[model samples]
Target chain A: MPPESTSNSRQKTMVIVGILALIVIATAIALYAKNKDEVGTVTENPAQTSTTTESQASGSTVEYKDGTYSATGNYQTPGGTESITVKLTVANNVVTTSDVTTSQTSQEAAEYQAQFKANYSPFVVGKDINDITLSRISGSSLTPRGFNEAVDAIKSQAQA
Target chain B: MPSSPRLRLSQPFSLKFEAIGTSWTIEVYEAYDRLGDLQKSIQQRIAAFDHVYSRFRADSVVAQIAREAGNYRLPDDAAPMFNLYQQLYDLTDGAMTPLIGQALSDAGYDASYSLQPMPIRSVPAWQEVMTYDGATLTAKRPVLLDFGAAGKGYLIDLVAQIMVQADVRHYSIDAGGDIVTVGQTLNVGLEHPDNLNQVIGVAQITQGSICGSAGNRRRWATYHHVIDPHSLTSPKHIKALWVTAPTALVADGLATALYFAPADSLRRYFEFEYAIMHEDYSLVSSPGFPAQFFGADS
Candidate 1:
């Protein structure tokens, strides 16, 4: 009778150890899942904020009307303050011609203007005036410097 | 490792580097010095030169000349290129004409390389339409001059001169494939035409200019950018040519012209040491060329 009671006690002890191990495993898995959820949420939060910020920054789009729109901006060069005027001939939402009228630019800047006229203007002629990237010309450095400044001013005024 | 101590100077000095088109940067050891100001002044001077000589801009002197079919008067800044053009015209036996723009256009390079293929048409010979009289350039017919071959190299030479004028002793100007070096030695790796990843030869350029001409990167089919004036077609004989000279412009211009010239004639013209790669991957160099350029016996 004593032996049977000892054996039963040992079996009960083993079962309790098994239960404790299962509980520890479950707890570890739960903690790991919680940590993963926290990390995922934290990572997604910045992405969501950035998306909202981007939407806010670029939300406004400029509307173009049929007719000629012109704007001018002055830039400081090595020689003097040069004024660059951009005259855009917009018809049916497309820009026909983007002519730079003012001629206070340095000789280098003038060369920039001619290149802009020859290379860039042709590509933008049939494209939507508002949606076209005026900043793409920035790769040309000097030419883009004058043109982009003028275009940015026009873009802001048009948006307003 | 011990760090080197910074030396204190009694007077300030300015070093200026001019290369890669109109862009220039100045390094000054001291602030608010006359030398520093001079560096900026030198930069402006070079920038003005760049403006006048730039072929990318339609209002540039080169562009104006091109638009007017070499009829326009050469600007003071472009006098050097104009002179070099005349020299190259005579040197190539009229093989490398500045008026090869129509030929390049007809060979499917009418616009920028980034653009797609345009309609290819037969172009008339450049020598038949264009004429130059040392100072004045006149076009008898509608002719286009494309200085793509020698433009970058000439620009490099100009920048090297500017650096010398500015008293910058140690520097290098590398515009794409064209390179000019001064002061310190610069290691130049000659790219293999078949495999761009590998270097076929390496040369140490100390004070001279070196140019590599190959159709590996810029070409359509077997016909590459280097057009033979005699045949008006891409030559299949030579795959690559590398030349070094006192001036970058000459080296670059000769590299392109010789690639298109007949093998025998080219060998005769290139009396100097050079490395030539044949279409079948066989390589040959001038006997006078330094054997040290190649790691092993060629």
Candidate 2:
């Protein structure tokens, strides 16, 4: 009878340990789940930020209004404040023809300005306004410098 | 012996067009102004040239080679270009990889600027199996060629060569952003990549070509045209690079390699001038770089 009671007591202690082990494991799992939730909430993906910007303003796919828009891009060279007057004619959400006339400057400057006028018109002529990337051709180190700004200014006006 | 009056100094004639999936400009300072001839000739020349190298065109040599990976007898023109490529491949320690074609397609630059679906495939490291003899190109493994880095500038060099061969001096070939001058000192402003309209500095070139490669343009999903092969990472350090050399081929190749190499280390292999914009928006230039560079805002 003494031996049998001792055996029963051992079984009771084993059952209590089992219950305590289960409780410890459940608490550990809850903590892990809580930590996972915090990480997901706090960590913001870098990729998400870039996509947000592309969807809003500078995207080439934006369905801009078709109309004539004009703007001036201002820059400062060593000489003085320089400006290029841009007149854009948008048709079917694209800049069909652009006229860029620059304020007077040196001979090299005038050539670059002329080169800009020659290029600025055709680059945006046919494509969807949303698809146009002015940086596609950033112009030569010497020529076609200020043309992109004029394009951006005109693009702002073309935006519906 | 009087020079041809048409070859004398005259009002600069200009031509602009879109080609190779980018903008192109031709400026003639003091030479025969054959804008009409230039328009017809350049289009035909570009079409023929693209048939061989353009990855976008499925029928191109590069595309066909990618589709069928094996030994191929390269065309006559491809020899010189490939020779330069092999030299560059050796110099950059595989950083300038010609075998990065498959990676580009898988990344989304497949054809016509269309972005393919995700789960981008890990590109095979091609330098291990690809081989190029003097005239024959062989690949024991699959290799696709994207040549986006120096090909446009090479094309500009070829076009400029054609003009020079035609005895037309004082002509400038601005194949979109790459510019080569024959007989004039053109003062050019380096366009700041961060601010497209702003100039980083001004450079005066008497002759030769000046080419700029910027990461600010031609970006999609997670890829820029310039990819580093060893790391298989995106453009992280260099934002923009400008190189001046005797030809567009050298200038263009060096400009691309500059992205991988520090400007000081490159002095041993090649002699050229360069200015680079870092990822942090700071500017670093070679000692002999003939440009008046600007800092962040000033």
Candidate 3:
């Protein structure tokens, strides 16, 4: 009778421990699911922000009409104020051709004009060759000099 | 002895003829009774030059050299011309070479004007295949030598010398677009590579020669006369370039050199002024290059 009573107390304690362990495991699972949901929301915010930023960039972008354009700009040089005319041809919003004409009012500016180098721009217009009376033309179509000093040297060498 | 009467004409005396597959004009301010003699002499000189240098001609000295490799005698005038070519070849690191004749012909610029491109072989270096010691050009193998780069300029200088020897004080020679002016300053138009009817700018030449090289003309199938051997393709970065030097030889040679190297590099070896037009139509000129650009409004 004493042995039977002891077995009954031990069974009661085992049942209590198993029920407490199940409760603790259920609470830990619930906290883990909540944390997973929060993590998912945090990652989604950056994707939303990236999409909005890209749309804003597209809205602010400028598109240019394809055609020829010309403008004149003036800048102060050491000599005086010099005006330059720029001509450009734009295609697909990109400059395809450019030409710059410098008109220097002061003689000093004119002297240094040769050093002026034009960057790639959209200026594309120029005077027609037919409109002007050119004394001569330089190109492949017309085809066609130190030579004296070299010749003199050659002649003297031959005589020697 | 009675001298020939020098007739002061209201207009300059001019002679026009066709040679070396191009038109040539020789103009002088004063007319001479010996104009016919002068014309004959000029024709003979050009004929001799063409006979010796023309690779298109089967009987040309260059063609003979192409047939077999050996030591060949070149003309006295070849000294300065060859020297210039050697210097340019060294300077450009074989970018500009006379050995490009084979490449040019292979690209369809041949004696028969085939205008058909074939498989191109890399051009052998000048040092490897041949040796040019002033007068004698020794070739190790049969190589086609092309003087098309500055030959015309050298010839122009030679023709000018002929004129000077003839006692002509003021003269201008135009072979196609290349012009040499003496005792006068002439306004020269720089032709637009894209549009022949218009000019991009104007330059003044006085007692100097101005020569231009462009990709617009003499081009076929994306290949122009100027070819880089390393790539075996025509240079397309530059649309056109013009060089002005005391002699036409320097101007003409440097015009081709500009396609490979910068103006500052060539200026170190030769005294010349240059204007380069990039493919985008951007203009770059030397500080002393006497040129004026016409904008859209002009």
Best candidate, lDDT-wise? 3
Worst 10 residues of 3 chain B by lDDT: B1-10
Give the residue spans of candidate 1 off by over 4 A.
Answer: A1-160, B1-55, B69-71, B77-80, B90-93, B114-127, B221-223, B262-272, B290-298
Expressed as tens digits, the lDDT of each residue in A99-154 for candidate 1 is 44446446755654454334222211223323322211100011123323443554
Model 1 chain A: weakest 10-residue lDDT segment is: A134-143
TM-score of chain A of each: 0.34, 0.35, 0.32
Candidate 2 residue-wise lDDT, B51-131, digit = tens:
988987789888878777788887677876787777777777777877777777676556644444354555555456677
Return the top candidate by TM-score: 3
- Alpha-carbon lDDT, every model: 0.50, 0.60, 0.71
Per-residue lDDT of B22-44 in model 3, one digit per residue for the tens? 67888887766788888888988
Q: Rank the candidates by lDDT, best first.
A: 3, 2, 1
Off by over 4 Å in 2: A1-160, B1-10, B31-35, B296-298
Task: Give residue B61's lDDT in candidate 1 (0 to 100).
Answer: 59
Candidate 3 structure quality by residue, lDDT tens digits, A61-149: 22335555444444444455565554455444333455555577877555444334323322233456766668888877442112223
